[model samples]
Target chain A: MTTTAINTKQFMTSEQLLEHWQGHRNLTRRVIEAFPEKELFEFSVGGMRPFAKLAVELISIGGPALKGIVEKKMDAHDEESFNPKTKAELLNKWDEETEVINRYFGQISEERFQETFNLFGQYEFPVYQNILYFVDNEIHHRGQGYVYLRALGMEPPFFWERF
Target chain B: MTTTAINTKQFMTSEQLLEHWQGHRNLTRRVIEAFPEKELFEFSVGGMRPFAKLAVELISIGGPALKGIVEKKMDAHDEESFNPKTKAELLNKWDEETEVINRYFGQISEERFQETFNLFGQYEFPVYQNILYFVDNEIHHRGQGYVYLRALGMEPPFFWERF
Candidate 1:
């Protein structure tokens, strides 16, 4: 009898995925810190929103979305709810949200990751995909931040140096 | 005897991952198409590199990196080689690279993906993480493209509409 090797290997555990995501988060937080206080709030490229606004959008989504996912609450997307006027204020919120994400993300079981959930009452996708969306969206914004930093004649964190 | 369900289910197949990456690529291609020829090459916010240059970086990496992975070639990264002068020329190269990615990506066996690869003679990582890096990097640059498009008063393709 001839048989093929059915690949049963796990690609990544949930914990590994979390670590990978948090690595990106750490990089993004650095990006946020890299910006000049005034520029973070006031810089723009080709009429794009400043990095501060972009960072706020991320802050609004990640921890809240994970909390929503864990709690099974499909609250409407809220970009305007949290507004920080200063860099320190924003970073404080960011740290708080990081803790929130860690708490909620750990609560998701492997099976639940396969279940479909409507994120923020829109963007219906599997729980894992939703998490991926959060990560992907963050990376995209961080790329813009890199550009913004370069325009400001400052160096942003290296993309591959995520630990 | 009591036993717990050992979560052996797969999160995504290699095929599914390919499709996911391609979806982002399709969205990015649309962004490239949306840019005015001059603006694509010349536009900047805060002195960041132009979208054209960023697009070239993607082109330089994706297909070649995949080929390198499949062939086990540790060739150095090359971003300065292909110089497309027009939008049409760049798009053609993009299309060609897409095919190249498909071809090389398929050649990697399931076991091989778990192997470590020194991508571009730098950035040593497991093959799967290397692939993830490519996707993440693309999303990041495309994010910059979104800002550029908006600054020009043109609507970008929705980030979620990747198909």
Candidate 2:
């Protein structure tokens, strides 16, 4: 599949995208920090899944995808691989994955950003587009985290402070 | 304000970014289509702003930014400029801006992506980062739209269909 618009003109580098992704990740970590323990696991709006479940979905995707990309291994998403029983465990898992990403993202060389890789054996695209996907997806989910925090009467980390 | 991790390694082109952004915009428009009339404007979880408010903020930002980039003009964000009373009005406004973006995005030269501009007279960054910010912000809000739809017992359009 043609996964991106294919404008490989190079506006940003691998390291830059990595930092961009991590900055958003840092802000998201703050969002996780602000969540009330019970609300993180139990709060629901109009029957939507709790923020914890959604957070786990994000936590499950990133590190695994980056590992797959770096290792050239493919694994379809498996929810059973992680079943965090509490907010603390979930947060710990998220931080562990963040560490994994920081390590693995750097392993992919600059040229790799231009090569096409089948992401999770599903998306076949350049490494740059795949990296953009990771950043875009996190920002998207973080949007929800913002709402969940607001609903709980808490202020989320400032959106601009993604560092 | 250095707003991005600017390595200036150059990986994507202006046209490619525009296409990528349009793809995301297409999905978001479909998301807007999925909203129920009343819930689009009235629904809120906790004390979060309604999805309609979020949508307008997006609609307001993009077209003007593109116009600014294309014409070398700058306008600070003024929230009072829009206060849509209904979903139809909001959707119409969104379409108008999309058309504006479509027209102006093409006017940007390839080299323009490397030049720094103050997005909304606030963020001083390269044209590429500013464009990325537009896409990033939209995906973030679309995340909220997803939650609102799911909470209303509605399934959103699949997120990957950016065409």
Best by TM-score: 1
TM-score of chain B of 1: 0.94
Q: Which ten residues in a row have the lowest lDDT in candidate 2 chain B?
A: B1-10
Residue B107 alpha-carbon offset, candidate 1, angstroms: 2.8
List the DockQ of the predictions in order.
0.39, 0.50
Q: Give candidate 1 misplaced runs (Cα > 4 Å).
A: A1-11, B1-11
Score residue B66 of candidate 1 by CA lDDT. Answer: 94
lDDT of 1 by residue, A1-163 (tens): 1112323334545665777788998898899998989999999777788999999999999999998999999999899988899999998999898889888887887778879999899979988889888999899888888888977889889888776
Error of 1 at B36 (Å): 1.5
iRMSD (Å), candidate 1? 3.6
> How many residue pairs clash (N, CA or C atoms closer than 3 angstroms) in each of the candidate models, in the order given?
2, 6
Minimum summed lDDT over a 10-residue window in model 1 chain A is located at A1-10
Over B1-163, each residue of candidate 1 has an lDDT whose tens digit, in order, gives: 1113323334545665777788899998999999999999999676677899999999999999999998889999999999989999999999998899988877777778778999999979889889988999899889888878877889999888887
Error of 1 at B79 (Å): 2.2
Candidate 1 clashes between residue pairs 3 or more apart in a chain or in different chains: A46-B151, A151-B46
Instruction: Provide interface RMSD per model, one decimal.
Output: 3.6, 3.2
Candidate 2's residue-wise lDDT over A1-163, tens digit each?
Answer: 2224334445555555677778888888888778888888888666777777877878877888888889999778665678777778988988898899988876776667678999888899987778777778778777887777777778788887877
